[model samples]
Structures are given as C-alpha cells and as structure tokens.
Target: MPVPRPFPPRPFHGWRVVQAAFVLAIFAWGIGFYGVGLYIQTLSASRAWPVAWLSAAVTFHFLVSAGLVALLPDWHRRFGIAAVTRAGALASALGLLGWGWAPHPWLLAPAAALTGVGWALCSGAAINAMLMPWFDRRRPAALAMAYNGASIGGIAMTPFWAWLIAGWGFGAATAVVAALLLAVVWPLAGLVLGRSPAEFGQHADGEAAARPPPAVAPAAARDRAALLRDARFIGLSAAFAIGLFAQMGLVTHLVSLLAPVLGVQGAGFAVSLVTVFALLGRTVTGWLLPQGEKRRLAAAATFVTQVAGSLALLLGGDQAWLLLLGCALFGIGVGNLLSLPPLIVQAEFPPAEVGRVVALMQAINQALYALAPLGFGLMRDVGSTAAAIGLALALQVLAGILVLRRPAP
Candidate 1:
C-alpha cells in the first residue's frame, strides 16, 4: 500500500501579525511621517508661513513622538498593544483634524504634538512588539514585508496629498485623510494585533506543538543602565542618528529642491520613486542577506549610496534626469535604514532586552533626526539651496564612516 501523503503545514499566526503590522505601517508612515513635507509646502504657500517656522512644527512633532517612543516598552507591558494602538488611532484623527483647522502657526504646535504621540504608539516600535512574540526563524522576512508598508505609504500618499491639496484645499484634504486613517487603522488593531501567540496557545513560526517556548531573561534596570554606557549601543546610536539627520533633512526639502525643475506633480513622483527603490532594497536584503555581519555591512553600504545620491542632486543642478537619478540611488538605502536598526538589536541583544534597547535607540535617533528639517530649513533661508543640501551630504558621509567602523569587542 502507498503511504498517506504528508499533512499540509499549519497556518502561522505570526504571518497574520505581519499583515496587520503592514497595514498599520502604511497609515503610520504615510500620514504621520512622509506626509509632513507636503503639509509644510501647502501651509507655506497658502498661508505665507516661513519655511523654517513650518518646519519647526514638524520638528516638534518628532520630539514629542520620540519622548513617547522611549516609554513604549513600559507602556506595552502595562496597556497592551491593542489599547495603545487604538488610542493612538483616535489621537491621530484628532491631531489631523486640528492641524487642518488651525488658524495660526502657533496652533499647529499642539496639533503636531498630538500627532507625535499617536505616531510613537503606532509605528515601528509597535510593529516590533507585535511580531517579536510570533516570529524567530522568520522574523527578518516578516519585518521586511511589514515595513515595506512604509514605502508603499510614501508611494501612495505623496502624490495623492499633493493632488488633494491642489484641488480641495489643505483643510478639506487634511480632513479627508484623517477620516481615512480612522476607518482603516482602528478595526485592524482590534482584530489582529492585541494578543501574543502564547495567549492563544500557539508557538512562534507555528513550530511543533511539543516544542517549548524560548525562555527570555527579564531586562533589569541595571542591564538597561549598563546598555546606556555600552560602546556598541553608543556606536549604533551615533551612526543612525547622523544618518537619519541627513536623510530627513534631504527628504523634507526634496519637493522644494525638485519643484523648480520638475514642477509640483513631478516632484511628488520623484519622492514616490525614492520609496519604490527603498522597497526593493529592503526586499533584497531580507531575501538574500543572512542576519548578522552581512546585514550590517549591507546597511553600511546603503548609507554610502545615500551620500552619493546627495552629491548627485547637489551637482546635477536643474537637470531633471540627474535629479531623478540621484533620488533613485538615495531611495535604494531608505527602507534599509529604517528596518535594519531593530533587526540588529534583535540579533545582538537578549530577547527580553530587545524591546528596551530598540526603544532607547529609536528615542535617540528620533530626537536627533527631528532637528534635520529645522536646521535644513534655516540653512536654506540664510544660505543657498545648494549649501543646505551640501551640509546634509557631508553628514551622510560622516554617518557612512561611523557605521562602517566595527564595534568594539
């Protein structure tokens, strides 16, 4: 007699979590992060606000969000992911509405602060916490798929917002986007994200029923304190801080940089192109590169491309082809920059400590990168656009060097 065919593999809940995280990331990054530059341009044109002043609002948003991200580990433990995310969704809606209706520049500050809080709850840190419990062997792939939502967000929203503001006015356009956020994100949080695998009697990666859950050492206060002083953590923080500072500054000014040459719509498309290549970069790294040193080296290389991209834009002048080429090279590294940090922490640190370490690093990175737009904007106001961009490029080069240096033993 022929043997019975082997049973099909059971479905993994981790993949489900990844799907939920993907959707959440789309809204979080699309509206919360990537959309800010669009807002800055619209508000500046319509209200005649100074670019530096409007950019400061974006900086404030990041500062508040960074502070909240630093507290996420404790918040996740106390409130659960579902509650935190749901609350974030509500806050984001309100923040968007407030931003749309704000009558003066000062009013934008509180609105941005609210958005910051919502972003801290719903973005990368939230994705990490949700997926960590349900993945191990497949974590990198899961993260890559989930985080690609961020690039997709940039692809979808940049042009849409530009068109929306052009047609419907900024206030109405902002209101519509806010409604979309609530409708899309709230239900997903309730359905797929609240509970961990253990809560439902499942193992990570859907391993055999007989397999025991991995034991994670609880992170002690002293351990966290020690991490603060650790050379590796310090190195990672410095590299990413400088890297993101440059990246954010360039991206925030990208539309303004390209608009004179490409017009508003063309500039939006250029931003989308950057995200498209970013998606490809993250996908290739996740699929082909093994975790650890190879991944770290790949990340370092991406920053080098970012430096090259910056130089191209600066030198390309008003040539559309050259500017687009520069964006393509820069985009190749964007997603990897966002996705690699948590992966590196997960690979190097203890499982229990991963959350805290990631939180701390994110907090520090956000705090530094928050200054990018404001600094770049001020430079643009006082110096030439080329001077502003040149400064950003120099920072990217510094970051590349810092990241390439091997950590101390």
Candidate 2:
C-alpha cells in the first residue's frame, strides 16, 4: 500500500494562505451569512406569517451586525482570529441548533437572529480583518474570491436544504446545518487560522517571510478625521446603500415575490439557480479585476443589466426562464458589491484602520440592508410590481449615477 505523505508545513508565503483563507471564508460566510435567505419560505409556509414578517429576522440580523461592527477591531485585538472565529462557529451552531426544532415563529426568529449575529462577528471581525495582514498585492482578488463563497455556498446548499426541508422538515435540516458548523467550521477556526500574518513569520504585504510589515505612511495612517468629513466616501457609502437596499429587499421577499412565476414546485429550485448565477458573477469579477481598472465598467454594466432585468419583470412578466435571467443579472451587479467598498476603503483610508473602515462600512451596509425589505414590502403592499420596479429602477439609476460619477470605490 502507498504511504500517505506527511502534512505540509505551514505556508509562510505564496497562495496557500490565500487559498486557505478563501476556503475558510466560504463556509464561514456563505453557509453562515447568506444561507438565511433559503429558509424564509419554509418559515413563512410553516407559520403562515407574511413574508415581510418572517424575513424581518434577516433585517434584525443586519441591524445587530451594524450596531456591533464598531467593536470588531477591538474584538480582533483582544481575541485573535482563532478565538473569534471559533466563537462565531459556536454561535452559528447554537443558532442553527435553535432553528432546527423551532416550533413557532417566536422560536425561529430568535434562532435566525442568533445566526445573523454570529455571522457578523465571524465575517467582519475575523475574516476581512485577517486578510489584510496576509498579502497586499493579490488582496483584492483574494477578498473577492473569499466573499464569493457566500454565493457559492448558498447555491450549493440552498437546493439541498430545500429538499431536506421539503422531505424531512426544519428540525432535521437544522441538525445537519449544526453538524456542518460544529464539525467543520468550529475546528477550522480554532486549529489553523491566525490573527495576523506576523504570527506566521511574515509581513502583512507578503514579502519574504523574514521581512517585517512596511511602516504605514503618516498620511495613510492618519486619515480618520478626513474619512468622516470626506464627501467621496460618504457618497460612495450612500451609493452602495441604495443598491444594497434593493438587493436585500428582493432577497427578503424573493420566494413570495416570485412564487407566482416559479410556482410551488420551482420556488426552492429557482432560488438555488439564481444563487448559482451569483456564484458565476463572483468568480468572473474576481478574475477580471486583476488585469485593469475596470471597476467603473463593471458598475455600469451591472446597473444597465439590472435596470433591464427589473423592467423585464414589469413588461414581460417573470416566466421561469426570464426570472432566472433576471436573477443572473442581479447577481452580476451584486458581485461588485462584495468587493468594491472594501477596495475603496483600502484606497482611501489608512491601511492600519482597514478593519475599522470595513466595520464602519459594514455597519452602514447592514443598517440599510435591514431597513430595505420592510420599506419595499410597504411599497409593494400598496402598489403593483411595475410601480415597485419603477421606483427601484429610479433609485438604482440615481445610485448608479452617483457611484459611476466617481467610479467604484
């Protein structure tokens, strides 16, 4: 019999760090962060509550995260990656465990809320911050691929989760999800992850293992006051907030909103398919960003496509194929959302505060995301799809113009 090779020594440089980090971000966020959307319908169906009511749990998650992001840097400093990540994993497990057997909306809401809270801690505090200390040059692509894990995980698991929910029920599915969190993520967080590249005998910028991290320029390191006063970052944040509002709004009511088109048989199937397209968007954007400064091009293309797709629903209606196409377009636009703000922060803010900057941005992003679904639900409550789409398109155009005027951050 062939002998197994010994385990590779811990990588000090090159792509291994990036690879490990990316894989970890995927399971850490996708299954943890975006996977909540998959259960909205199941909750609504079982409870007979309005989609708005049940999906509000997602908004609550966002709210909690927004409130907590300011503390992320402090948390990282105090606990390190392994501790923070493991805590997140454990929170996820407990949350999922809570969700699995939740007998009513009261029980499920808290469970889902816990999962979202855990995600905020793990995703923002642990993953995003840790990446900065690893490599500077390939950071954009690495961050892109890592966050893309959300779409990838959602795509891969949503369908199966749907099947499980359909065949077995929420309790068993929650158990499986709990197992995935506890067995895989909890261990990964504690065993292999580190707080900063320095722990691995390397600089944050990924030069020779022995080189210390480059000292930050006084200018880059001292931009905090400027960041708050800066119109550019504020505008950029607003622009992102507008788009996120629409996207989160859609996710909040996706199953109910499109149920007419997808029908009962295809609801779960359609969501998974849309998420697959989102995965494609993430992969493509991560690849294209390396060769050129095409952030503007990406933003423009996505805006135009989203405009057309949202209008298509008004004009032609959401046939299965058309709806899928719209989902793809939405995903295409959203891929930029995953990376652009982080990239912008790296550019505009001091490198040392990258973690702080993201915390701020994420707070803004999540707060707006939390408010959107209810706002849209209220809009849809009183009007037709055409009216809602019209408003969204108009808002999107405003955001597009605002963002494109300056180029993506």
Best lDDT goes to which candidate? 1
Please report, in order, the local distance difference test score of every candidate based on alpha carbons: 0.84, 0.67
Cα lDDT tens digits for candidate 2, 1-409: 9999998656565355455556666665555556666567666778665676666666676677678766777777887767776777777778887766666667766776677767777774456676777756666777766766666667666666778788988878878877776786666565556545555666655565445555854544334466566676677778878877877776556667678877855765666666666666767766666433356556656667667666665564756777766666766666677676776566555577778777777778778878877787788879966677677777777777777665333
lDDT string for model 1 (273-361, tens) is: 89899999888877765777565687778888888898889998889999999999999888888888888777777677788888888
TM per candidate comes to 0.90, 0.84
Best by TM-score: 1
Error of 1 at 354 (Å): 0.8
RMSD of each: 3.2, 4.7
- Give the residue spans of candidate 1 off by over 4 A: 1-10, 166-168, 209-224, 381-383
| TM value for model 2 | 0.84
The deviation in Å at residue 263 for candidate 2 is 3.5
lDDT at 223, model 2: 45
Clashing residue pairs found in predicted model 1: none
